[model samples]
Target chain A: MISIRELHKSFGPLQVLTGVSLAIESGKITAILGPNGSGKTTLIKSILGLVKPDRGVIQIGEQVLNGDCRYREDIGYMPQIGHYPENLSLNDVMTMLQDLRGGKHPTDTQLLEKFRLGKEMDKALGTLSGGTRQKVSAVLAMLFNPKILILDEPTSGLDPVASSIFKDALIEERAAGKTIILTSHIMSEVEELADAVVFLLDGKIRFHGSPTEILQNTSESNLERGIARMMQEAVHP
Target chain B: MRTTGKIIKYEIRDIARSKFVLFYFVFFLLLTEGLLRFGGGSTKTLISLSNVVLLVIPLMAIIFGAMYLYHSREFTELLLTQPVNRHQLFRGLYLGLAVPLALSYGAGLGLPFLLHGFNAEGDVALLLVMIGSGIFLTFIFTAIAFWISVTYNERVKGLGFSIVLWLFFAVIYDGLVLLVVAWFADYPLEKAVIGFTILNPLDLARILLLLQMDASALMGYTGAVFQRFFGSFWGISIATVALVGWTAIPFWLGLRRFAQKDF
Candidate 1:
């Protein structure tokens, strides 16, 4: 479980996160939905300790995430763009991660096999297509079998088959009781895997509850329409 | 230390795999060997090579180091999310970068010297000084570039700053120093001149190389004064210390910025 309290972050005049406090429970895929420039990525990065919050506190389980970085051991983060050293092949990336992570623990290679990255491990990251690179990112995120996985735009570049494969993997991880916090613009994907939903707009949490609740409140049947309706209210309000 | 080692291992692996370092290695080897082969008067060629090192090494270090740090940023960000110390990560990266540059400078220029018959009293000390100064410049400028990369959010801005920094030390600084000295001709400015030279790593490196080559005639008024003041051993020591200081301070500043920076 992760808890953030009164987190306020600003980039110059633009306030990305404004007094947003959230507690994400374990064993659920919490899909953080937001519009462009809505601070969803900032919020996620803040939790991953990638973006330092200007104010407030974050706690993972019971330990306060301050200057100590050891807690990040439990986190596997798949960055949005997944830029890596262009010279290095996929195997080099895997080895580099293994080395940087230090000490040998059990690593999940299932995702690698699922993506069939083993055959293409010799290919340099620069040569890979965007979707392939995303698959690499996904594999790295799931490899460590971290208790918390923070995936940014997890399926943006994936093909239908790869995306479905990824979704199935997420479901499996959820079944294994891992806390998954993912940000995606894809509502159908969110509808498929997200156990609970957290909607953010203008650096504030607009809605946080079950997907059905959002549908009921907005008088819509499906998630896409419900979210659209919610956005409509925001625009008018 | 173990984690630092592991990081360095992978980091070096990454750098070595890149074409940048390899290109550097080949360029230096061909240039050095080519000079040795065609250019008559080995000593003159060595002196000219020293001049080349003085001008080119710092520039290469700045461009390469800045580009590497900026490009490796995504890799750095990914590592940030892992359970690793920032200080160690930076130290590892610093060493990872510095080591290859040093090795390439050594071997590229070095193999030529060995092939041409190296000696302790003959051309060996001069070659050693060239290699040493080259290494120092690499470390110093790379540290500066690292600072630039970490301190700026935008890569273009960071690289721009790095270029300006390289220009200031390599070209502009000496001209400005000459202008200042000429302006203050009536003032007792030897100490001030030496102080200003110490402030710039390229100047310090130039002095080290020039003195090693015993070509102080080319060093101008301050070089003679520098020789008189510090003598040989003390001069080398002071210059070496200055170069070390230049390397350490910027790297430390860069490390501090990196530790505090958000991805």
Candidate 2:
């Protein structure tokens, strides 16, 4: 389980996250839903220790993040726009990452085979298409069989088929008792996959519950309408 | 330590594969070869090579180092998410850049001189000083570039700062020193001039090589004063320490900032 308390962050005068306290349970899929500039990425990055918070305590399992990086060993992260070394081929990148991670764990190449990326492994990352690169990101995220998976917009550039493959992979990982946190704009995807939802607005958590609770609270039939209603209410209220 | 080594290995491989680094190697190789072939004899060639090395190596190291940092930001971000210590990563990145550039420079100049044998013992000493100065300038400027790159997020700003810094050290600093000399012509300025030279890494390097070459005669009255001060064992030791300071101060500052940087 991962927990954060009183998390705060700012870029210059622009505040990105404010007093965000959240506890993400293990063996579940949690979706962080927020509009643009709502601090979802900042929150995620803070948890990953990529962006240091101004004030907060983040604990992952039994380890507390006090500027130590070993906590990230159990976590796998997929960036929204995966920017890798342009000169390295897909195979080279994979090998380099494996080498960096120490190759101590038994590797998981299921997603690599499932996405049929072996044929394109020799191609340079710079030359690959967006969808192909997204697939590569997905493959690397699961390669270590990490205990926690944090995916930022995991399906943005994927085609319909690739998207389904990715969603299935997420499901399989969740079923295997891994904690998963993902951010997405696709309501249908969230409705289908997310076991819990945390809605953030203006750098604060406005709502956190199951999809049914959010729908019932907003008096809406679908997850999209419920979130829209919440956004509208916050803006006008 | 092991992790730092792995990071350095990957970073060196990445830099070595770039066409620009290859171009840098070739540019130095050809320039050194041309100077050796047509530039009169060994002493004259050494003089010309020192001038070129003193000017070009700093500019190349600063510009290339800053540009490489900016270009590889994505890869940097990717690494940050992994289970790697930031200090080790920073050291790896810095050394990965400095080592190859320094090697290329040393080899580029060293190769041609090896082919054309040294005529005199003094010529051999002068050549070593020139190569040593070039390597020092490379490390010093690359560290400064890393500091600038880390401090500024915008590429244009970081690059502009790097170029301006190079211009200051290579050109403007000399102009300013000359102006100071002209203004203070009536005063005893030998000690003051040495102090000013120590302030700039480029000047320190130039004087180190020029004093070794015994070309202090061309520098007028000040040259004799410089030879008296800088030609001694104590003078050389002081200048070497200053060069080391030039390389360390910027790199230390850059590393501190890197550890605190959000990205």
- Best by the lDDT measure: 2
| Model-by-model DockQ, in order | 0.67, 0.78
* Candidate 2 C-alpha lDDT tens digits along B6-65: 988998899978877778788888887888788767788887777788889999999999
lDDT of 1 by residue, A79-159 (tens): 889887777788877777776666475688999998888777998788889999999999988878999999999989999
Instruction: Give lDDT tens digits, candidate 2, residues A33-61.
Output: 98999999999999888888999889898
- lDDT measured at residue A126 in model 1 versus the true structure, 0 to 100: 86
Provide the global lDDT of candidate 2 against the true structure.
0.88
- Which docking class does model 2 fall in? medium
Kindly report which residue stretches of model 2 are placed more than 4 angstroms away from their true locations once superposed: B219-226
Using DockQ, give the best candidate's number: 2
What's the CA error at residue B171 for candidate 2, in Å? 0.6
Which 10-residue window in model 1 chain A sums to the lowest lDDT? A97-106
lDDT of 1 by residue, B37-146 (tens): 88855676687798789888889998889888888887787688788888888998888998898898889988876787642364777888888889999998989889
